[model samples]
Target: MSWEESYHGRLRAMAGDEEVLIMVGARCLLRDDQGRLLLIRRSDNGLWACPAGGLELGDSIRECAVREAWEETGLTPTELAPIAILSGADTVGTNQWGHTYQFHITVFLATAWTGELVTETDETTDAGWFHPDQLPSPRTANVEKSLALLAEYDRTGVFVAP
Candidate 1:
């Protein structure tokens, strides 16, 4: 379905133009065969970010994450393990469209996926894999923190929040 016909879009249409919406979304963190993290350059914001989107009605959060990963990165994350669940007043942000949102997102680490990789998409302009210590510039504000969560997970084998 078109984004405007999706659940959040319908909800946003009902809310005031300036209202801050509480949106539930999910991020897919994928690794290439060489173990680099995957990031997408968001078309709307021109910032590098993990493939993500708001959850739709009649879909679980994991479904939302996998679906968004497929749409934005052209790969279906086959095996995902939730590594972090983040949400707070601090999570609020205004998009390029000036729509404000407080994001509740689950960050998923994918162990396997299917399909050939494609960078260009409706939501993303580019995609690439980066080593943990060598991320590209002009990335999303939360990239470091998210990576830190992943690092913690690697060291401790525990999710950031659960």
Candidate 2:
């Protein structure tokens, strides 16, 4: 089972379905040598997003970022630098199983990586690299925010919060 299913299942069993759960996760803004950004089309929502997922037990945020990127996009991150920490009521959502969750998502920039890009059939339907100016339409809110932060980071060497 995935981390979400395992954790949500355990929580539901312990606290009942009405309890709101807080999930910590990480996302990687993977860039190729040519400076193209990597994006994955999620199987569940059919929306393009950065490679990301909830932290599994015993995994650090950096490890989570690396693992999620590899799992979803077949890339092995060699270096990761944190870019932003996004949280708040706006990050709250419900899964397909009707379990409510609040997310604390740490966004990371992978400075170096290597792998053949292939989408994980279970999680993503497609994966590709795109120039920032030519990004796919209708990206997730977090992805849009990450892209903005990435630009700001590139320009100023620091991520400025909005």
Candidate 3:
């Protein structure tokens, strides 16, 4: 959906950028056979992040993740399994556009996907796969949190809630 048409975007427009809104979003994590993580360079902030977006009017959280991944990178996730619900008090931030949001993001692990990768889109300046050990600079802070959530799931063998 266009920013003007999205629920969060309309909320931001009505409430204004300075007003902090509670937002629900989702992020999808994809890995190559080599275990390299997929990352996108966001056009808005130039921050490298997983393909993610806020929930639109009719999408389930999982649908949002898949939609976002497709929108930003042209990859369609065939199967996405939720790994965590990241909604901590610290999960709040003001974007480069000065819109503050407290995010309730569902992070997903994509076990299967299809489509050719596109490096550039309206939402992203560049997209590529990277090793966790050698991530691109000026990446999103959420990258670390997403990884941590996954690690927590790994350690506990349960879905993370934080």
What TM-scores do the predictions have?
Answer: 0.94, 0.86, 0.95
lDDT tens digits, residues 1-162, model 3? 678888988888999778889999999998777878899999888899998889988899989999999999999999878999978678888887788888899999996899999999989999998988899989988888887877787688799885
Better of 1 and 2 by lDDT: 1
CA-lDDT, candidates in order:
0.89, 0.84, 0.88
Q: Ten-residue segment with the worst summed lDDT in candidate 1? A: 141-150
Query: Model 1 over residues 44-134: C-alpha lDDT tens digits?
Result: 8789988888899888999999999999989999999999998998888997778899989999989799998899999988999999889
Global local distance difference test of model 2: 0.84
Q: How would you encode candidate 2's per-residue C-alpha lDDT over 1-162 as one tens digit per residue?
A: 664476545666787666789989898999877889999999888889999988877889999999889999888899889877888998888877677889898889997888888966579999888998898866777777888888888889875544
Q: Which residue runs of candidate 3 sit more than 4 Å off their true CA positions?
A: none
Better of 2 and 3 by TM-score: 3
* Comparing 1 and 2 on TM-score, the stronger one: 1
**Cα distance off (Å), candidate 3, residue 161:** 0.6
